[model samples]
Target: MKEKVVAINRVAKVVKGGRRFSFSAIVVVGDGNGTVGYGLGKANEVTDAIAKGIDDAKKNLVKVPLYKHTVPHVMEGKYSGGFVLVQPAAAGTGVIAGGAMRAVFESAGIKDVLAKSKGSSNPHNVVKATFDALLKMRDPMQIAQQRGITLSQVFNG
Candidate 1:
């Protein structure tokens, strides 16, 4: 699986002796074939935190519906203070997004898309919002089936 480290934060806690420091990592992982997941892990060391994150992400893997190297339709997602809007783009447009969102897209094997994150720049919230948007995506064929119509009828109508 391919993995991207979206953020690593050094957190400190006050103790009797002094300040104790730990590392927190947020990571995204994928098979580069429409499966992706995100996780957050904290540990005393960066490498350990990253490893834990990868394991957690693998457990949360989700399959994304892809069409022509992009999302099938427009989507909006929100998590706490973060909001994200994702839409399909032309084949050659490439992934147009910011830091946290880029990692999620690349991991999900999205080659073309237009995404915007608003309300908060925090990686954690942005990633969650992006996931929400992706989880809500529905392929046209799936929609047609759910509506008891043929795929062609959906687009034709």
Candidate 2:
């Protein structure tokens, strides 16, 4: 009762034999504690597809470190011929992203984010690239520690 599924889609492929149909699932799972995950799955059936996607997503879950209600920095990421740009915005900025990108941000518990997708209109690749960007995100604390400098000095520098 604590899990939520966002969407499911049917994808098709035509071969010599006939038309082959598969399902694609986009799932948003979160605890509302600044943790969320997005997954994509394809299968012969909707339920199986969703189950597969959810399982895979859980297994690949990455914690996105948040600053207040937004990301810690701006980052760009690419995957499977898709490109995504993610920007941190001031509070109340709201989510300004396309459908695919929106699902990724919303599931990640981000309240305010700005995103742009390019190179590919395929939702799967776009969302995956966005998640990759989120996974690469680093907070100030981590940066300061890695640089062996105090937080104040790091910020000032």
Candidate 3:
């Protein structure tokens, strides 16, 4: 399968009595050419949390716009309190990102991409919003059909 569970992190919440620990997971799944999915899970155990997150991600797989080996355009989205920006890049550019963002791209089989994450740094929100944005993407074939035009007319014309 092309899908992968990229990273799992232990998170803690401060409470009145003590610290409450939980596991946060980021799962990325893709077919490399264009489709990718990212998911987050929070639970008492790291394995269970990651497994749940991956399952959710698979259930929510999305197809993103791809031009050559990179994204077709730049886009942004917000989830919870995090903002994510995804941009296409030329070949050999590689993925210029860190943290959960990088893992998302890698699992999605993206070799070259540019990304920026802002606002809340929560991994779950960031990953989820990114997936949301990607899921909204439109491919040339779909666009041509929607516009009632040929692919060449829509792109080359």
Candidate 4:
């Protein structure tokens, strides 16, 4: 598996003597075979922040349903003020997402998808929203089983 640093920000806190500076990093990890996760880390050093983020991401992993290099269906996810809409795309469409959404899709091994982010643009919120959407995805087989129907019945009947 490999990890990608999606975003990093330098944060500061005012103190008695001066401002204390720290780094916050968002990281995405993936095997390019369907497994993926994201994490946020804060530290005094950029390297440390990224390392922590990777560790956090590994602890929070989700499995996504992939179909022909895209998601199985269209869905919407919301977190706080962040809203995200994800749709499956043609094989060659590539990832049509920006900022945090793009990172999430790439890490999830989704080669083709269309995503739109609305409301708050905060990276944390956006990332969480994307994950929420992905988690809601249901595989066709799972859906069939839940409904007490066989796969063949679904497609042919």
**Candidate 1 lDDT for residue 28:** 100
Clashes of 3: 0
Considering every candidate listed, which one attains the maximal lDDT?
A: 1
lDDT of 4 at 108: 79
> TM-score of every model?
0.98, 0.84, 0.75, 0.94
Could you give the candidate ranking by TM-score, starting with the highest? 1, 4, 2, 3
Model 3 residue 44 distance off true place after TM-score fit, in angstroms: 4.2
Tens-digit lDDT string for candidate 4 (2-25): 798889999999999999999999
Candidate 3 colliding pairs: none
lDDT of 3 at 143: 83
- Give, for candidate 3, the lowest lDDT window spanning 10 residues: 1-10
The lDDT, on a scale of 0 to 1, for candidate 1 is: 0.96
The local distance difference test score of each candidate is: 0.96, 0.81, 0.77, 0.90
Better of 1 and 2 by TM-score: 1
Off by over 4 Å in 1: none
Number of the top-ranking candidate, with TM-score as the measure: 1
Question: What RMSD does each model have against the real structure?
Answer: 0.6, 2.6, 3.2, 1.3
